[model samples]
Target chain A: MTSPKDNKSQIWKKDLPKHTFILLVLLLELFPLYMMLQISVKNNVTFNANQWLPITPDKWEWGNFVFGYNLIMPYVANTVFVAVTGTVFTLVFAVFAAYFFARYKMPLSGFLWAVFLLIMLIPGVANIVPLFVLLKNMNLLNTLWALIIVGIAGGQVFAIFILRNFIEDIPKDLFEAAEIDGASHLQQVINVVLPMCAPIIGTLFILEFLGKWNDFLLPLIVLRDQDLFTIGVGLIYLDGEYNKDYGKIMAAFFIASLPLIIIFMFTMKLFVKGLSAGALKG
Target chain B: MAQPISYRKALNEWPLYLLVIPSLVAVLTFSYFPVLSAVYHSFFDWRGGDAKEFIGFDNFTRAFSDEQLRYSFFVIFILVIANVFKMIPSIAVAVLVHRLVSENAQYYYRLLLVLPMIVPGLVTLFIWKFFLDPNFGALNAFLDITGLKTLLIWLDQTFLHWGVFRADAPIAWLSQPKLIIPSLIIWGFPWIGATGVLIFLAGLQSIGTDVYEAAELDGVGPLSKFFYIELPLILTQVRLNLILMVIGTLQGFGLQLLLLGDSGGPEGAGMVPGLWMYNRAFGAGEFGYACAIGLMLFVFILALTWVNNKFIRVQK
Candidate 1:
């Protein structure tokens, strides 16, 4: 009912501060990163001078990125191998487990799900000491397999939780229709549930990727070999050895962070969508 | 009449069970197995290098009676206060971002907010330590320009010698056992803010627009709408954030180590449970005792989380 003239001015005025704060917040958020980047580009001599801004006539020192890559590349590859293999295993197991939980009236299903809820609440640090012993006993210490196995197990609960919710959203009649066609439960899961839950699965994949990629504490304790370090563990090494080399460390951080940033940028909407959906329900 | 089930019926259902086996094995081996072993180890005096020695309740008694343990608990008590201040800024910024008009603008702000989360704790720890260093750090540089000489000696007790440059300053930050808790709080708060924002943003996105529209029609301004409509709706998110922050703050180590060093700084100012457990097991070579301490923390955290869940019932 407002006049067009009044509405136009009101809308414009409301948006200006929001836009300003948005820009301001974004800049403030990036400040630390900017600092990190500044450190990485400068050489030791320049960095020691403690110049916050990079001055003219100094190398960007792109070698820091290369050095970081060479230092952590094997670890990166190892993480990729672990993550991909773990994700494959996690998704496979979660699908069937979530399917069983959702569709079947199995004995103690409720009890089993309650166990998952309990495990989810307990933070990862609580079990580190015992896990170290268990892995030693199993002769899995310093092995990439240990990391993979642990990541897969830890990753499944969240994936299963989300996938179960997503699967429940599929109309029951779809499964009933497949049943009427003489399809087995296995076939029904593969044919109907899997395809419909693709969005949620994809979302879980990114979450798992970011998580395993950046994980530090577990890799620090579990993997003794320098070669098996993930980006996070590798960065820890960089920090220790070149503690004063802010420039190189910053450069290394930028290089290490790029992949995650790119992946997040591309799949952001889906990430938020899946996360909020899960959050809302929980 | 009931017919005997075909063998195929059992086989068909086996895939479902089969699919969950790997996950179960992994969970049992990595998580459940370790947890139970930790409980078992708590009763022994097995150091990392030595044979396991039975200690019964000795380790538990030591952990409870240790003065340093009592001191860290006091630190955590102070930290809980700092957390209250942090929650206010986090919620306000998150709510502000939700009100922004342009999608592109929101994207930039969100990415900016996410920047801190992406900063690895180890790296950020070192960076902040350098900044907070008593000597020749940027923080002191800024303080000097503003005629704030008093802030310099407060950076550390030994630096108070330079208080003459300040007219009269007391080096207090790392040296004072009492102030170190607040110091730790300052270090921990910014790192956690990003995660808080991201979680809150997700919560905010889920709130119904119709509620906001109705509020606007009822002559409510943006600020009032936020307090009445948005805040209540996002209480679940806030509660979730509190649960996470409590667990993380209780367990985290790198920052404390970075600022206070492995000795837990002067007078054990920055000691928390994680560092305490690490020192006992790794430093003092008391693996069994360390495992006991770790187990105690696990039980404490589990109880806290359970209590929080019970107390914070979501409106929905």
Candidate 2:
């Protein structure tokens, strides 16, 4: 009974609140980021005066970025070394375990997989004290090796859980075809499993890399030397040093967060898929 | 014909077992060993050095009796309550974003919502620390610019009569005991947690569209559709997120540690059990007491997780 114009108006009425809500949320989510960007460029004198402004071109001081970058570049490099090595080790161990669990029927496979799940249930903070002592005993304290080993070990359980599901989902025919052609277990994994599990590998790599890069407490506890700090630890040190210098601190914040932001922008789809995949399936 | 592999057959499958060895070794060394050590260390009076004595449940007894540790449990309870309420807005936002008219807009909005996840969590907390600084914080500046500062003072004096604020005084967010918890709650205002949204969205998307159309044909309104369809369907994800959040809040003291430092905030108001464990082991060299605290927390989390699983299964 309603006219086409009336129907159009009703649709608008229904959507108007939804659009408004979304826009408000976008503003709230972006507000601190906008403030960080604005303060990073604003000169110290004008920072308080124009704190609420999105940008101030006339009074901008680009020197903040230069100063912050110089201070944090070494830390960024250290983080990259740690995150990359950690991800590679985690992926290597996790892929092998996942392939074995998915394709091969080894003894006590069910029990082993259950134990991994049980490990996930144990709250991580409970292990911090004991792990600290363990690292200290091995004389690995104050070294990146401590973080790297823990990162790889901690990341593998979740990585294997998700990767096993992904590998199991691969068509059985592909593996059979490879095996019939005389592919050994290792050869079949290399030829069939690795190629089919690329998406998941990419997903776990990004997730684990991001987690290692953002980790604060482990690095703060393990590493004592300023030169060996990760970006998260380095930023805390920067905050203490430049406590009153808002401009410089914000600049450091931007620099510390830049790599992950860049990565997320490029691989956002994979990141989302990874997040949902682990949670939904697990 | 499906028989279990014998020892000889298992030996023949050595390659597969070999592939799992590295992970097994790593888990045993890092994960399992630490837990066992936690249990073993809890019974001793060892500090950092080799001066060890078997205390035999003294650490556990002391932890149970410690007044400060009991206060921390209360603080943790408040934080967990706040966290539960925080999930509501995250779910609402996810549902709203799901109903967006344009597919491109929906994708971009979801991306924008999650963009903050890329920022290091410590940096975000630091930015909030600055934003809540009493003297020159952006929050106060915004209130001043909007004339809300005067309005708030008037309301405080006339209606609420709390007498806590003067017209000229800036609120000390982190320094005051009363305002510390509120400041923690407000730190991530609008609380659009990226993972929560994504999980809920995935749950919603998995529902068939035909159910929605059928509901519409039944003259179901938006509220009815949400309660009757969306709510029940996404309950599994909701339950999962709740369990995760509960576990996370109980185990997490990083934010509290970073914000309050080793002192556990002003008057130890922000002290949670996790931070207490860190302080006991690292700061005070009471490793035995720390281990006891850690074991207790682990058992509590395990019990809570089991109860949650049972409750959710019963609801189904």
> Best candidate, DockQ-wise?
2
Off by over 4 Å in 1: A1-23, A48-50, A56-59, A176-187, A274-282, B1-15, B48-50, B101-104, B115-122, B133-138, B146-180, B188-192, B205-225, B257-262
- Evaluated on CA atoms against the true complex, candidate 1 attains a DockQ of 0.38
Off by over 4 Å in 2: A1-10, A180-182, B1-8, B145-164, B207-219, B314-316
The top-ranked prediction according to TM-score is 2
Candidate 1 lDDT over residue span B110-176, tens digit each: 7666556555555566566655555535555556678565544454446534332333443245656
Cα distance off (Å), candidate 1, residue A257 = 1.4
Residue A158 accuracy (lDDT) in model 1: 81
In candidate 2, what are the lDDT values of residues B1-316, reduced to their tens digit? Answer: 1124577877877878888889988998999999999999999998966778998999999999988899989989999999999999888888887766557778888888788888888888898888888887877777778988888788778997755456768877788776778788877888888888988998888666678678879999888878888888788889878888889999999888887786688998888999899999999999988999999999999899788667666243
Task: Quote the positional error of residue B128 for candidate 2 in Å.
Answer: 0.9
